[model samples]
Target chain A: MFDIVIVGGGGAALVAAIEAATLGKSVLVLSKHYPTQSQTSMAQGGINAALYPPDSCDSHIQDTLKAGVGLAKEAIVQEVCRAAPKAIEWLDSIGMPFSRKGEAIAQRRLGGATYPRACYAQDYTGLKLLHTLYDNAVKLGVALRSRTFLLNIIEEDGVCKGVSVLDMARGKVEQILAKAVILATGGYAKMYGALSTNGFGSFGEGVAAAMRAGAKLSDLEFVQFHPTALKKSSILISEAARGAGARLIDQEGQEIGGELWTRDRLSRAIFEAMEEGREIFLDMRHLGKEFIEKNLPQERKLALLYEGVDPLKEPVPIRPVAHYTMGGIDVDENMQSSIQGLYAVGECTNAKLHGANRLGGNSLLELVVLGKKAAQSAAQMEQAPQQKLFERTKIDTNFIKAVFALPNQIDFWERQEFLSKIMYHNCGIVREEMRLKGVLSVVRQHQKELAFMGVRDKSPLMNKELINFLEYGNMVELAEAVLVGAIQRTESRGAHFRADYPQRDDKKFLAHTMIWKENGVLCADFKPV
Target chain B: MKIKIKRFHPHFEPPSIDMEYEVDNAPTLLDALLQIKRQKDRTLTFDYMCRSGVCGSCAVRVEGKEVLACQHIPKDGEYIEPLSVVDVIRDLSVRLEDALVTLGSSKAYPLDMQKVAMNEEDERLIERQSDCILCSGCLSSCPVYESNEAFLGPFALSRVWRYVADKREQAKKEHIDAVVQNGIWDCTLCGNCTQVCPQGIDPKNDIVMLQSKAVQFGYQNPNLGGFGSFGLEF
Candidate 1:
């Protein structure tokens, strides 16, 4: 058994593996695909660090709290913001190759920041950081098992016992026992499907598995919609482009200002405009070719490739797409979930850092700081002997077989597409009691239909259809939770805007929406911040 | 659009075959592939994550030219197949295990680097090299690695140069030594890797720079003979 098993291959998981290995613990990273091909690579903007003079951590913390709209935990916010500089230093020591201002790391202004505090490496910030972390993990001899899908977290008698995974390459289910397991499995914004700027695997399966293993999840209704994704394809044109002076314009060529506001506000503004039947475009033509080439090269490439519009020559059509989920498995300051020895970090966990909404550039920072923190905490815990296998395993196996044996009467793709459309329309950026209930009923219908779903390809080796079907199951489960949370939280705050209420009701709904399973039935409650 | 896909399964009959389908409303190769998998045959296996070009999971050869399936718009009757350089796991999903191993063996990351101040010029010098997405498109087009598996291909060599040119790195000599054998010298400078790189990283030029650095360190090309034209031994 390994000391720590990380169940994702993104920036958070790699950093955790490096930290655990540095602590001289046996660690293994299980990835559904190669480590580098993760959602973290899609984070093109920079990571936040208050390194520039006169921009203290206090300002950064205040900015973050303001962006979170009164729901961010002060303690966690302070811890993450205060640790930002040292985190950037650690990254630099490992050769992150950050874009440099003379003799120092370059800092840029991201939205929702009080200062130019984000240290970047051109526009490929996340990609470069992820590669550097992967390189360090390899150099430190971290064992990696790619093509392994996390089926469930093994919990016996309310204690963590590692995980059960499907060996995609070998086509079999196997259980791995670890002293501790960290879930760094990323966000679930892709539940919005074609309307989201997330990878295909961002289905929140890890969060679902953790919840099944008796973990509490929180604030799942707070999904941040980025203001400027390429309209044709939901591929994100990084906020760095706007930070570099790209303007948002309406179809009449009139500037719709608030280009540098926090993501929620800008997205709502654009959503309101689009509701009025106006098309929005990101105008970067004034930024000049040299500046675009040097700083925002990836933005230019994405705009040209995806939408067939060169930002240098013309305005690129854009819309607000679901970008980041601010809600996930609820964890304490130590990054431990409700289950013992079950830890979570990164976008997959709602550590109360980004309560209602996440500030720009903070996600990458959280991946490093909290990733290392979770690893250190897990390593220092006393080793627990292996417990007997739980009966839940047998039940889960039967369930899997039942799913495979069901008739293929309903096409999984069609159902998935229909679910995405309804979610985007009824449960997306704007929501109300009637529409949310409408979508929730549809989601419940889909859950009922899951019993009739099956894949035509019985051969399990690298079965993409099987994976899609399973992901659909997970998505349906999470969709119910999201709609329930959205329906329950009757006040408008941060990303969860309620058109019915139309105001932040801090009096009654200031607390977080907590969801968990009790006796195999989903339940929701409120936890005071 | 009509597209043909090369299908293979180790446990299936005949092992390999070409299947064609007419995909409507499919704009990109990835869309067409997914359409076929969803509507025509559920058994078609491939891999993709971020339909955006950032994640490198969707790289395959379309009409014998390596392109990211998500980014490349397909022409009518174009052929899609797995990358020729790697072992196919099933159909279009090539095994990246061997290529990742070559990357690990290169030791391309910064070694024994001190925390030092860096300027914009220094950072810009290595910026292009660091943009590599590790897509293996370079290895797919690399002529030298086609024959010699031991050769450290374009992806790893470019990463090696990324660190060697950085101002913060202190162990440049060690990095040079790491690439001297089967690494930089094995490259043919054929420029195929440069042509196929979607990110525009020029590994061929980076290999030439490594050669110059080696010459500065008083190391001769092992391919060169010891005897001079003047018969200096007399």
Candidate 2:
């Protein structure tokens, strides 16, 4: 048994691990992949900190609250904002190579930011911060377990005690006992399928596993669609392009709204334009070759490799794609979920800072500040002996060989693509009641298909199919939850847009929509911000 | 394009088999493998994430050349294999645990810094060096590492150089001394590691920089110390 077992290796996990280790707690970090290979490493834009002149954390909070569209909890926003500068300092202390101006760290104006407050290390801000934290976590002497697939959180009488994991490489299953377990397991944006900005492992497994353990989930309907992902491939083109003077052009090649617009507004505009068949283009060519080369090199390289367009020569074709999940397992400011001895942080938690839609660069900021807060609170909790031993029956080879020849491979993939298309069309940037109903119907059927088909792969060594199968199952559940919550919420607010009821309804729909599995159905409820 | 992947298993005869598959319209070799796995074979194994190429998880040897499968398009009749000089976990997926463990061996990070302020030029020098994704591509490709396993490899040496270049690193001597096996002088500087880097980090040059610093700290490869300076003696 360990003192603490963190279930993910992104920014949240490392920050928490470092804090716990410093407090003399034995720490174990189990990552599904290499810690640095997380989605946090994919964050291209800078992190937000009001460190420059004429800018303040309060103003940062104001921008975040505005972008969240009346859903941002004032207290949570204030707390995170207050901790933002210290988060930057923490990152620097760990050797984050931040790009600096004369005396202070440099800041660039992001989409929703009132001032130039995003501190960066060129374009690879997330990579810089994540790697630094990773090094620090390693230095803190925390034990790391990689390529371990988290099966579920073990709870006895509503207290999380440990986690069951499938060791992918060695082809074994193990029950790791712990006093406290932190689920920094990211979000379900990949449930939006291939068109999402998240990596392959960002399945809402943490939240889902907790939900299965009788934990309630909050705001499942709020999925933020990024305004600019490559046209052919949905790989993200960071909004920093706009900060560096990139423009969003309509099909007519005329500049409409570019990077200056807030994420929600920009996503909506892009979706509308895309619906009108006016393809959106991120025109960074006018920003000049020098600026694009110096700062936006990664963006340029991705454009050339993935989308086959040079941002320096022409406007790269882009459209709105599902990116961030604003809703997740509800947690307090201490980052403790409803379950005792269980914790959630990073994008997996509904920390209530980004209530409906997250601001640009704020996710990375929350990753550190909230991650540290969770560790501080978790470190004080008394360690209790397990009431029940959480154990897997066995790693059976028969279970891996369950896939049937009846469902052809092409047919299986087509179904997945179809389901993704449904999510993209109905529960996307713009939503309609009829479309959402159609989506939910198909989604529920897929969920049944997913459960009934216990289809799997035989080999246990690096069994990616088994991982994908589990992820698909989680995605199906999360997709249903997303649609169910979307269907229940009748008003347009933040990313939960309703075509039929195209108005922000504070009278009835101001609160959050929480859902949890009960009996055989997912039941929905509400909680005030 | 025809893709041939080398398969490996412990109990199996010959311990490896070359399996071929047909692919079409795939943007990269990683995409082709994904297609084959999803539709062709269910049990095929490999490591990958963020297939857009930054994660460096999907690295493999295509046509005997080290490349990120997410960035390389499979050519006609391409033979892909696991990264050489590393023990295989299964097939293309190999054990990088040792190489990855060495990433922290030099204490490359600023362990004792109090978040002190620094100028842009101070950071700009070590900027290119900090871009390592720890894919171990350089380690797997290097001739020196292939010959001498104790060489600390290019990534580790470059990591040490990243700290040595940093003004914030107070314990620079500990970091310099950590790269021991005459590590700085052992490098052949053949440019193989630099050529193989997906992120274009010049580890070869960084190794040379570390070598220069090591000599300044009165260290040299004992293997080469036998040869005296002929020109000065003459």
Candidate 3:
């Protein structure tokens, strides 16, 4: 059995693999797609670290806490912020050619930063770090198995024995025996469909799988809606644009916020502007074509390729899209889930680093630092007895066949489009009791249709339709969790803004909303902050 | 728009197939491809992830040109084929196992035994070289790889440029040597790879840059003319 099996191949998973491998433990990184394609590579801004002037760990923590709006855990925030500088140093040592100043790596101010602490490698900071870390992990003997999709974790007696993975290449489901399982699967913003800044694989399958294995998820409602996604495809136009002098304008050409507002404020401003029948656009023309072509090349290419707009000559159309999901599998200080030997890090777990909403640069920081902590803790663990007992879940061939042949009445595209419209309009940046309930009712009504969704092609090789159907169903459940949490927390705090209840209520709701399956029905319970 | 994909399974010739259902609003070609799978047939498969172009997973031949499906808009009669010069698995998907093998021989990742640092200004000159997503659009489109399969190809050579341009790397001779072995001289500099790159990365320029770096490193393409004072009077 492998000493550690890491599911997902993003930044956090790579870090965990490296750390685990460093401890003389055999590591396996199972990824749904190639590691380079993971959502971590989509991170355009930069990683946060108080490595330069006007920036300190304490100040960075404070900015993150303020942005989190009362839900950000003090200790966890301290953990990530304290490790930020060292994390940057480690990444640099591993050949992350950070964007530098005179002799030092350059640090710049991102949204919600009190100082210029966000370190970058041009605009593709994540890409630089991800490539280096992936290479280092491979050299360190971390076996990265691509095209392996995790079905579920096999646990018996509160200990994770291993996991069941669908080997896509072999076209068979198989068991992977491991002492520990780490879910580094990223966010579920793609649950919002075309209205999400996430890539296609960002659906939170690991979260759902962990939930099915009796792990509770915390704070699923507070999805961060980034302010500067392209209006057409919801492809992210990075916030770094605003950091480097870009402005948001409503139709008729009036500036909303000129370059330096928090994401929550900007998202609300754009949402309110759109509601007022004003089309939103990101104005970066003043930054000059040379400045853009030099620093923000990724943003320029993304604009020209995806939206067919030139940010240099013309303003790019923009709107808020669901970017990060703060809620995920609940983990402790050690990053261990409720079930023993099961760990989660990165966007897939609620490390409480980003309470209601994450700070601009802290997302990448938390992934690296907390991911390392989890690896060290797991590596230090006394090996659990290799018990023969397992909660074996037999594959029901009849049910599998029945699911394929189900009389799917509703088309998946129409259903997804309808859901995206409902979520984008109703449960989006601004939330209300009536709107959340409306979407919940719609989901409830379509439950049967979802169950009966059928696949026409019977060829089993590379059944993307089956994967889509499964993920779409999970998205519905995960979306329901969001609506449920939104309904539960009747307060405006961080990203969870309720129009009906316009004030932050710390007395009754200054806690993380934990949601899980209780008796096959969704149940929400609050845990004190 | 009727989407046509030349479907191929292992050990069989590709079959022509058109999608059944019509999608109302597909923001990109990827969305349309997904709709074809979801609304029509579950078994019709292709390799895709990160509908965003950054992932490089959804690269395919669209109307005889290599492009990222996620970035391009779908046109009617779109003929989806496995990106050329890669092993075909099934349908539009290609077995990418051997796709990036040339990168290792090119020493794409720095071969530094010790950690090194370079100034940000120095890195800025070659930073664009790092953005090659290895979508293999360049490799698939390159006439060098199409003819001489052993050629180091476009993306890998571009990566060598990314490293050779780096002032931090003390020892880059291995990278230069690897490129020469893989026939750095084999590239035609036709610019097909540059046209096909979704990220706007210029592999042709990078390859030429590597050639310059190779000359600076006391190596010259063996395919070039007589070294004996034939063209130059010293």
Candidate 4:
């Protein structure tokens, strides 16, 4: 039995593990795959912190609240902002090679920052930070159990117990008795098929597990779709590109002006252009060939050296992809969920800071800041008695096999491609009531089709079959929650723009959307932001 | 155009199967596979991303070695299939995700940047290697990875070297000691990582630097050392 069992490995889990170890708690990190594979490694932009002289906690809070379009909780935003600086200092203390502007830490301007307050270690800031944090945490003796997927959270008598983790390497399920648990399993953006830049493991297992364990997931409807992901591949081009003066242009090379415009506006514009038979490219031309050659030389190299395109001369095709999810496991200002001794952080939880749309550098910032808070709180909580309990879940091999044998085994890819097209056409960027309802109906049909998915390989250890099966489940739930939330919200704010509503209606829908799973059915509730 | 793809699976005969594809001028090699899946054989599978190549997905063996299918231009008579050695997922998409496992497993010195003041040169040296996108390209190209599954591949080791070389990062000795085990020592100092690197990061040079740092940390490659030597514990 351990003091804490942290499920999922990402920026939040890594930070929480570090903090827990610092506070002298015996902790185990259960990562479904290797720790760094999480979307945190994919983070290209710098972390947000009010380190610049002109920047203050108040200003940061105000910006976040305004971007959130008034749905952001005042206290949570304030707490995250106050904690932001300390998180930066901690990262700095632990050798985050933040760019320096003559003895002072150099800062870059991202979408939401009023001033240049983004501390970066070049473009691969998240990767560097994650590597640093993982190294530090391991050295401090955080027990990292890689290739361990949590089957379910074990709760007893209304209190949180340990968890049942499937030893993915050995193909055996085991119950880990622990005093507390933290879920940092990342967002559900991948549910939209091709729209997501999320890794396959990013299918919202933790959120589903938490919901299964009677934990309410808040703001499930407010998924933030990033305005730019590379076309076809859906790889995220950091908004830092826009922050560095990249523009949004149409097929005729007409500038949209507000390249750094809120993601909702940009995504809407891009989607509209596509609808009007125009291909959109996040124009990196303005950032200058020299800057692209020097700072983002690899991006140019990736284009020419790999794609054989002279990016300095030609425009790279681009599109808006489902980037980050703003809503997740509901947590308070302290990163504590309603369930005591359980905390959620990073993209896995809705801390109410990014109510609707996330600021550019703020995701990583929230990871370090509120992640530390969650860790500290979990560390301080009284250790519960060990409980030997394992939740029962059976894998139907026959069903899995039958699905694999279906004539349309590989057709799922084509279906997924179709799903992406539909999503981008209907539910993406700008949504209307008619389009949204049509999207839900299509989503249901897709979900039904996915139900017949079969696994070719039935192996228990590190089987892609099982993993894909799990991802399919996550997609179904995520699509339902997003559709429900998008349908229910009935307003325009931040990333959730409804053409039917047409305008930002602060009066009717300034609340958080909470989702719960009961009897295999999804249910929704609202909380005042 | 008639395209030949060399397919390999543990279950298949002769280790590699050469399959032919007919195509038109187009999107990508992956686009060709989708065409084949739609028209000829549905079993043909390969990994891809960003049809543009920024995501580092869709890497596969074209003629002899690993190449990102999205980036590698389609030719009239090209050989395409999954990368060699690693577990095959389907056709061209091998399960090479283990390339990043060492990043989480390695030990490094404490990150007390407040204590260490960095010079511009040191920062430049560290920045040069930190851009690895975790594509399994280097691993697919490495001969060492072909023989030894336990070997920490180029990407992870190069990244470890990236941190160890950083002036601000503490635990330089610790990082050196960390990678010298199953990490850097397992690398045969081949230039494959440098060659296949889409980002142009040289894991060979990074490994050499890591080796130098390991020496500074009073550690030696136990496998390479002639005399009985002791391993340093941080």
Highest-scoring model, lDDT: 1
- Model 4, range A263-346, lDDT digits (tens) per residue? 767777777778788988766776787787656654565455433456577777777778888888888767777676677888
Q: Which pairs of residues collide in model 3?
A: none
Candidate 3 accuracy as TM-score? 0.92
Per-residue lDDT of candidate 1, residues A1-529 (tens digit): 7889999999999999999999999999999989999999888889998987799999999999988887899998999999999999999999898988888888999998888989888888888999999889978879998998888988877788888888887677778888999999988888989999998989988998998887999999999999889998888988888998999999899988675888888888898999999999999999999999888877787787778799999999999989999999999888999998999999999988888888889999999999999999889766764665656555666666666688988887899989898888777788999999998898889888887778898886788788888888889999999999999999889899889988898888889899999877999999887
Worst 10 residues of 2 chain A by lDDT: A392-401
A372 Cα displacement, candidate 2 (Å): 0.8
After superposition, candidate 4 runs with Cα above 4 Å error: A164-177, A301-309, A380-391, A394-415, A445-451, A456-461, B1-114, B133-164, B169-190, B207-234
Per-prediction DockQ scores? 0.74, 0.67, 0.47, 0.23
Instruction: Give the candidate order by descending lDDT.
Output: 1, 2, 3, 4
The CA lDDT at A122 in model 1 is: 85
Docking verdict class for candidate 2:
medium
TM-score of each: 0.97, 0.96, 0.92, 0.84
The deviation in Å at residue A162 for candidate 3 is 1.5
Taking chain A of candidate 1, what TM-score results? 0.98
Chain A TM-scores of each predicted structure, in the order given, are 0.98, 0.95, 0.97, 0.92
lDDT of 2 by residue, A1-529 (tens): 6788899989889989988898898889999998888988889888888886688877888998888887788999999898889888867776888897875788888888889888888888888788888888777778988988887777777788788887888767677877888999999898878778877888888988888777788898999999889987788998888877788887687776644877878888888877887888888888898998889888898889888889889999998898999999988777899889899999998988998788888999988888888888887767765545444323323333444322433334556778888898889989999999999999888865763554446565677776777777778778888898999999999888899999998888779888887764788977665
Q: Pick the candidate with the highest DockQ.
A: 1
lDDT over C-alpha atoms for residue B219 of model 2: 76
Report the candidate with higher lDDT, 2 versus 3: 2
Which portions of model 3 show Cα errors greater than 4 Å? A305-308, A382-393, A396-402, B1-4, B11-28, B38-43, B73-78, B113-117, B143-151, B176-180, B183-191, B204-234
Residue A132 miss distance in model 1 (angstroms):
0.5
Give the distance in Å from residue A110's predicted Cα in candidate 2 to where it truly belongs.
0.9
In model 4, chain B matches the true chain B with a TM-score of 0.82
